[model samples]
Structures are given as structure tokens and as C-alpha cells.
Target: MRPHRCWRPAAGGWLGRRLLRPPGALPEPFFLGLCLRCGQCAQACPRSAIRIARWEHGLSTGTPYIAARETACDLCGGQAPACAAVCPTQALHLEPGEPVRMGTAVIDATRCLAHMGDICRSCFNACPLRGRAIVLEGALRPVVDPALCTGCGLCEEHCLVEPAAIHVEPLNP
Candidate 1:
């Protein structure tokens, strides 16, 4: 599991950041309306990816979200996502062809050892989308392909560097 570390947005954290939602989740408002805050998704997650929001999140308290840097959604292998399967309100959906669209990852090359002339493939190896989402460049540096990125945050979680060289930017809420 990835260790705890807070992500601070450019404008500061709580005021500017949005919570990362689970895969196939309805837009923020819609999901919130239908979600029963029952914690079923959290219980069903095999990877323990979903966490219920606490009081600090205001109206979102008890809502389900994926704190990707801490734990990322695995989409329950190739099967229907476990969280969505157990959600009685269907706040989360299942689309046959789309695997997921949690968010996209952006690499800070200054911190990336590979980009700094060291051989590293941590992000590439950790990406759930693998070859499609993260590719190795000529210098063996990992490059992200946004079109294929599922934003699972496995790359960020597996990063060997403290503060992680690569981090997942959450979807706009």
C-alpha cells in the first residue's frame, strides 16, 4: 500500500482540490444525489481502494471516493467493478467497452530519476494500462499516454521516490 502524503494544489488544498471518485461514477452532483453513503463500495472493494468520506469533507461525508495516492482502484481485475456491483443506488455505472476513466497522470520530469538520466521504469511497470497508458521513451524514461490512462494511481503508489516522481491528477469534480 502507498504511504500517506497530502497533495496540495497550486491554490492550496481544501479550497482548490476535488476528491477523486471511483470508476464509472456519475458526475459529482448526480453521484451524491443517488449515493446512500452505505459504505457498500468500500466493503466490496477487493483492493480496499474506496474510502468513505469523513466530516472534514462537508457535504461529502460518508461518500465513497478513491484516494488514489493511498490506494488505487483495480477495477476488480477484468470483471464488473466490485464497488459498482454492490452499490444499490447505481451511483456508479458499468459500461461494457470502457475500462475506466478515473483521471490522467502527469509526470514532473525534474523529480523523475529516469528523466534525470537514471534508468527507471517504475511508473511504466505500475500502470494498470501498461504499454498503452505508460510507455518507455528512447532513454528508457516513462511517458504517459493520456488517451489510455485510467488514472488508477498505481504508478504514483509504486514510485520508489519519496513524494513520488509521478502523481495522478484527479478528475475535475
Candidate 2:
């Protein structure tokens, strides 16, 4: 008897374990255990901020999720959110404030096309959270509600064109 190259079992335990994995590149917990590795988050993103976690986090590799290096959560509105809507799993949970229960969305008015008066609202429209999270300030400026904004970087990832109008930053305790 012999085993075929294509037909082989996993090298290690498939269940119960801490699974010491690699450090997440994305500022947010995009690679949280709850993630199903589906690229929907990336595909739906207008700004293309969402990307797959290509590196090996413990034993899993190619799992669909964003790495800290590639992007982070914008924490949309603090109420409604975009990524959460697309995410099949509750992996990308909800929270309030700049920490976004997970992360925070920061406004880089200088880089933001909306602030530049170029006309872009990918973030505004895509945001699942609202009211306190992200506020539509003036014509194009979007004010982040620190008390209600989660750091879920969705806004940053959905900005039209190049440099995202908004960016995600780890919530400062």
C-alpha cells in the first residue's frame, strides 16, 4: 500500500489548540479565528483596502482576510457597517468609538479625495455603522466620531481611487 501525493491527511491536529500564529499585519483583527477566508471583503471593497492574509498564521495559510500591513478596519458608523454585512462569519465584530470595538478610522483630509474636492463617497456610502461613528461634515469632509467610531478601516478601504481618504489606526487606550 502507498499514499498518493494528492491524497494526504493534515500534518497535525485539526482541532482544539491555541494555534500560535504569526503576528497580524493588519492593524485590526482581520485574520480573527472567526474569518472564513472568503475574499468577499476584498472584492466588495471599493478602495481595495481588504486583502487576503497570504502568510501562514500558525498552520493556516491563504485564509481570506486582511493583513495589518495591507490594511485595517475603518469602523464605519459605530452602528451600521459594510464589512460586517459581507462577512459570512461574525469574525469582524462590532464596537463603538475610535477603537471601533476593534480598531479606528482616522481622517487624512490631505490625502482624502473627498476633502480635496474630487468627489468621492465610497467610504460614506459603504459604511455599515453610523450616527456616532462617522459624521458627514460639510461638503466633503467626514468627521470621525471618536466616541462612536470603531477602528474598522472600512471607510479607508472603500475610498475611490488611490490613497484612501480615510485610514485606520489602532485605538489608543
* Tens digits of lDDT, candidate 2, 54-131: 333333444443333345443332334456557666555444332335445677888877788776667777666654
Give per-residue CA lDDT, model 1, range 1-173, as digits (tens).
Answer: 75225533322234446677887888777888899999988998999999887765656778888877778777688677888888898898876776788788889999999999998888888777788889988948899998888887889888878888888776646
TM-score of each: 0.87, 0.45
TM-score of 1: 0.87
Model 1 spans > 4 angstroms off: 1-15
Candidate 1 global lDDT: 0.80
RMSD of 2: 11.1
Best by lDDT: 1
